[model samples]
Target: MKKKRSNAWLYFFGALGGVLYGYDTGVISGAILYMKEELGLNAFTEGLVVSSILIGAIFGSGLSGRLTDRFGRRKAIMSAAVLFCIGGLGTALAPSTEYMVAFRIVLGLAVGCSTTIVPLYLSELAPKESRGALSSLNQLMITIGILLSYLINYAFSDAGAWRWMLGLALVPSIGLLIGIFFMPESPRWLLSKGKEEQARAVLSRMRGEKRVEEEAEEIKEAERQEQGGLKELLEPWVRPALIAGLGLAFLQQFIGTNTIIYYAPKTFTNVGFENSAAILGTVGIGTINVLMTLVAIRFIDRIGRKPLLLFGNAGMVISLIVLSLTNIFFGDTIEAAWTTVICLGVFIVVFAVSWGPIVWVMLPELFPLRVRGIGTGVSTLMLHTGNLIVTLSFPILLEKIGISSLFLCYAAIGIAAFLFVFFKVTETKGKSLEEIEQDLKDKHRGSLKTETRTAEQ
Candidate 1:
């Protein structure tokens, strides 16, 4: 018999997919500053270049669902790995603005698919009891990627070595490709394809054979009811699921956290810090992000999702308020600079442990088995759309309205996100996908009755 595989080995490498996605996204954060100088880009042009990847991401996310369904999840990830490799090489070699934009789009496509699929893939592989924490490994890897990129930026920032920053993403991309080779295909996906024995075989590697059999049976029953198409997603019950998933997706982007991730170095320079200080400051924020995400991974299955959302979003509102005040009242003083950093640091930690990781965990669980992939893809499409708008508009907004006003807008959006979570987002911790779906169906039934009564009145 083949040696029983431990999930530890699988998770380490499978999570590398997230690492590549994170590195690609994070590399541009600091590299964009240098790219602007080398390319002679204005604020508008810079926004255009940065936003271009998001456009690809929107489409990539939309397409990844079908790709995974038709080709299998493992193959889909392999395809993304190819894109990451090519995108990294092309981006590093680009000689002009148009080439860079196009290359970044390539990376965006890869990043989009990784972001959408890794958590889903991981969740599908993990047992229900440990699903929350295992899925969070994707987010943890993302923070790691971000921190790695910040370190790379700082290392190269002195010589304006933007190419190296972008090129280095190639390392993880190649590593991810090699690592996926050792992975077993997701048992859930295998079962869906009618390869029951193959699915069982895969599951056996992850757990005891009897447990694998029971779980396979459970997944089969859940999937039996999931025969759905696009229109199925619009059914009264299904619509609520879509709203909950997509709302968080859009709100995650609109909260403007990416503004810090993408433009922190430049933003700090504009505010008051020297180039070295700004880079160091950005790295500092990245450090907080990784550490807090680690803390989150420890407690996610233990603490529950709603509490994290409530706690984090509430703190975000406060942090953004403080950040805005510091910028407006204190201007460019060293004290204000430190204050800005502290507030952002808090926001980073809060979000790292909450919305950042939790949203990815929630997306896959929000839909029924039949439409889960498409539903997730559609939600991710909206997310990238929001990201596009925010990324594209940040520079223009900062120039036209200033940073204080931009952050104020984010603070207001935070209030709306917090309320949405309190009312709409249900806790899914420690629940299997089947259990979550049944609960959704029950809520849908009650909601339908209430609507019928209100309509009669």
Candidate 2:
């Protein structure tokens, strides 16, 4: 019980990174309107403004794992907090859209690093009994950040105060910096670095008197068998796991969650809400997201990852179809208004509960220890690359194809995602890192052995 209580504080600090990520991403949905008006951006330029961060994120996510592996997760996350402060302040004070885009890219880099590093750090630190709940806190904090941004945006909407919305990220970034200062480094990371004594000291505090040596030994064995490098991830034995990680990363974005998230206010405006109402409604969306994410955190372990993913994907598909049909039936004006609002609320709920948390949980665990860092980096790069494509193209797609068609496309992608999860993905609910690694190795050997026997015959 004491150990659980002590670990709770560690998880809390880890979650601060999630808050910055959520705030930075969510703030833009509301800020874009004021930015467009103030900076006089058209659809093309507006897309660039919104997507610049995603572009930067590709680099941040792709590189963060390597940096974390080398410098330790604590230092990587601290670096990310510093980036968030710089990016938030720069974006808030930008004199033009061009400068704003530049600042946003900086913020995006921070978001990318936080998104990758925080989950990895949390998963390593958490006890198996509480890992899901604790790890899910990352997503929970993200929702809180989202909700907070919406509330802030709504409060300042009348004043056209997008600068304040963008600037508010600094508060949490500072909190993250301070909170992480008091937190210990990941024990697993310490063990990887050959500092077994230091690792044991940290784990002892979190694991109590009974299990520290056992846990340390387990960490050491996992590290011993790990083949850490980018090239190793492509070896035949590791290929399947890499593919699974990459597939989840790709499908998470291909399903188009961000299309609605980053552009919710704009979509709401299309449906007929004025700027203030749209911003307020965006807050409502964020609130629902927070509430449902709490629901997910409570049940993710009990209900299991695969079931939640299946349900969420099915829900998203239906919601997107309904959303598209509503736009079709109501025409561009009335239907677009209500349809977007209702559909987005449903979609956010679905995403928050499932893919949002599960993808992060699954990616790091799927790869072997040797290549975990590089594999995660590659997978995260795929995620952000997909993000960049979706974000950069959504506005153009909406304009060219219309909202209904755009939604229809997303619905199709969601269906594909549902099928992929139902068939291809395995459940990793209760397995330890070493157990998961052995399971993969056994499966790999079994496949190879069968192939050899068949060839001999």
Top lDDT prediction, candidate number: 1
| Candidate 1 residue pairs that clash | none
What's model 2's TM-score?
A: 0.97
Residue-wise lDDT of candidate 1 within 326-409, one digit each (tens)?
Answer: 889989888888888888899999999999999988898888877777888888888999999999999999999988889999
- Model 2 agreement with the true structure over 1-457: per-residue lDDT tens digits: 8767777788899888988888888888888888887999999988899889988888999899889889899998999999999999999999998899999999989988988888888888887766777788888898899889889988888888999999989999999988888889988888888898888888889878798988888878878876778777887878878888888999898898887778888888777789898888888888898888888888887888889999999999999999888888887676567767888889988998999888888787787766666677788889989988998999999889988899898889988888888887887888877777788889889999999999999
Superposed by TM-score, candidate 1 places the C-alpha of residue 134 at a distance from the truth, in angstroms, of: 0.4
TM-score of each: 0.96, 0.97
Worst 10 residues of 1 by lDDT: 1-10
The Cα local distance difference test for each model comes to: 0.87, 0.86
Where does the lowest 10-residue lDDT sum fall in candidate 2?
Answer: 331-340
lDDT of 1: 0.87
| Over 4 Å off, model 1 | 1-5, 447-457
The clash count of every prediction, one per candidate, is 0, 4
